[model samples]
Target: MRWWDVEALMPLERELFGDTAWSAEMFWSELSHPETRWYVVAENPETTDVLGYAGLLAPGLEADVQTVAVAPHAQGQGIGRGLLDALIHQARERAATSLLLEVRADNEAAIKLYSARGFERIAIRRRYYQPGDIDAWVMRLRPLT
Candidate 1:
């Protein structure tokens, strides 16, 4: 992801993730991190407006999907799926044997998306989220490699 995109993504991050949204600086740092792999701004192919973004961090054979979000107005347009597909592809290419991520248990939409992508719940982190004290579902997907 480029530095220019961080400004645009920050608003969407706040809208979708509320208190969990990462700051622009965090995005910039991740973009430059050696272990971070990010795919940002999927264009319309014709119009070329950025539709979504996804990120992953692979420190070793295990990878963690740090975040994935699509524009609020662009939801349900398959942009999320495309971004997720790219993340999984990158993980495989990086020789990551397993992919991991934590999702708010209350976020059914996100849970469904991850499950459809073959991430199975392996554990639960009780009270993992603040304010509401919600649980986080820890999910993992094994790569074919």
Candidate 2:
């Protein structure tokens, strides 16, 4: 995602994730990180307004999905799935052997989406999230030969 998309993405982040939203500075850093393999902003094909974004970090043979978020108003419209597919494709193209991610245990929709995309629950991080101290489920997907 470009620097200009940060404003639009930040608002969406607040809507979908509340207090857990990533700051503009964080997005900037991720975009500029050398380890970041890909960061994409999904826009309306016709209007070109940013609706979602996904990021991937490759630090060796493994690729980690740093984030995948869709605007609250745009949820259920296949945006998240599309972004995820793009990120996974990029990881595979980079020769990443596995893709890993973490999702809040209470996020059923996210869990379902990850499962549908071939990610399996591999472990859990106890109290990985703050405020309410929610647990996080670690999931992974192996690259297909």
Q: Give all TM-scores, in the order shown.
A: 0.90, 0.91
Summarize candidate 1's per-residue lDDT along 45-108 as a digit string, tens digits. 7875666778889777999898888877788888888888888888888888999999999989
Q: Write the per-residue lDDT of candidate 2 for residues 1-145, one digit (tens) a residue.
A: 7778888778777877788878999888887875556799998889877799999998768999999988777889999999999989888887889999999999999999999999999999999988789999999998733
Query: What's the CA error at residue 62 for candidate 2, in Å?
Result: 0.7
Query: lDDT of each model, Cα atoms only?
Result: 0.83, 0.87
Show the lowest summed lDDT stretch of 10 residues, model 1. Answer: 34-43
Q: Candidate 2 has which clashing residue pairs, if any?
A: none
RMSD of each: 1.8, 1.5
